[model samples]
Target: MNAVSAALDDKAIATGPAGPLLGDADFQYLRAFVLEHCGIALGDHKHQLVQGRLLRRLRALGLSSFTGYCELLRRDPHSELGELASAISTNVTSFFREMHHYDLLVDELLPRWLHEKRREGDRLRIWSAGCSTGEEPYALAMVLAEAIEQSGSKVDARILATDLSPQALETARRGEYSLERLAGISAERCRRWMLRGEGEYEGLACVHPRLRELVTIEPLNLLHPWPMSGPFDAIFCRNVVIYFDQPTKQRLFRRYAELLPVGGYLFLGHSESLHGVNDQFELIGRTVHRKIAE
Candidate 1:
């Protein structure tokens, strides 16, 4: 099975008779609700996976039946939307998960932007559009911090990390991770950027204050209205649109294009492509696109 299928199937065991079973009508309502609110298209086969995942949520909310859960959504979808999306959607991410994207920033983009921005006094903004538990943005901040110091440029730069999952955003805000989670980071970066915990907090690592200062974490549902005005130099929306339907992808990419200037970059997941979805961005590198002048 594919990785996504495997992830969705993880721990998706059939509930016992003691627990409430997800009925067909309620399942359909959930499918539709998730699609409209979160932009994730749930296939018919995902019913059991959804049921298994949401069972935890049901228990948390003191709900005994799927009907009760659906009623909660009906009463106020926004109240439960983040928790619902967190249950259904996968947020598997890591520090420097896709290293090449960071390499591109370090080798080419950052230097050029710092140089140009130093001359023009323009601010640099990179949005980590689905930042998950903060690893990605912190990773970006490491490279960005290194670039600024090396270039000796006083270019105002920052990374905006946003995600829809309340739980994930809470972890991101905390910025602490188990030592094992540091595997993806290089040894030098780990030494330089990670503060090792002690005594009761042993085996945990916290990000340096510089990374926190560079990244602004916020809660954002990509399908909903965005509060920030833009002309962002680049956007890292990796592994996010894979769940979106065609129309949703089209709308999201169009919105992204509107916020990016001509020649601005859009970095996507390794498995995702803009082909036959959006024509405003030209393929510039592996899983990278640049906005084209109209």
Candidate 2:
């Protein structure tokens, strides 16, 4: 056999799974590699997750193996640099995914914020970091609108919703959702905040035009420097950071601390916690953290 063919054979041996579950050594190697490059780390349980998410990309790239793909990332730099992040990053979100956070925002945070600002401002700023499919931000706008109307207050509010997935951002910008995803949204909120489509658009409800106007969707990679200037009053960053390593999470929290002001709020996913890594935030509940007045 020629040298090239021999090299290919050797590469295959390294790339293919090394064990029953996953090649644990290779998994550790890949995790370390990814963390160095992107600040994301894969752990013990994510073996299947890495395989399932990156396997298709491997096929698409005509790369026969994960080892080869890792080589590409290491050497080319641009050779599908973002593809793996796209694969592994969790994008699951819905309109009001965890409803109580919205309740707390409307009932607790916004009211107090408004009172503190008093004649100084009518605008409220929010960053929906890791905003997936736009539903969360749209739902936020709906809730804020209701709160403003009920308070007999005219509040100018805008939400900066960013996500790494272009596809996800497009879905969010469309503001069109299937009926099944509307489960958490109440019928009353629906009538007031949605336009029920007819004919070919049947069974899909589009967000109200006014609500759509409230959110600005942007494509962003959280691993990179953020494209925002803030002193935002609140940030809804949920269900995305669980994939990162402890150090990365701590670094992200420091950044979060900078973006939000004293007494600002940070909402995390139900499964996430600020317990061990950072001391900057006070845990209010399971997923709610308050940026202490600083």
Instruction: Highest lDDT: give the candidate number.
Output: 1
True-structure Cα RMSD, model 1: 6.6
Model 2 compared with the native: what TM-score?
0.83
Clashes per candidate, residues 3 or more apart or on different chains: 0, 0
Cα TM-score per model: 0.94, 0.83
Give all candidates' CA lDDT scores. Answer: 0.91, 0.77
- CA error at residue 145 for candidate 1, angstroms: 0.4
| Per-residue alpha-carbon lDDT of candidate 2 for residues 128-211, written as tens digits (9 for 90 to 100) | 988878888998889777766666655667889988766687788899999888888988988888888899999998999888
lDDT of 1 by residue, 86-128 (tens): 9998899999988889999999999999988995467999999
**Model 2, residue pairs in steric clash:** none
The reply for model 2, stretches above 4 Å from the true place, is 1-29, 75-82, 118-122, 152-154
Model 1, 127: alpha-carbon shift in Å?
0.2
- Candidate 1, backbone clash total: 0
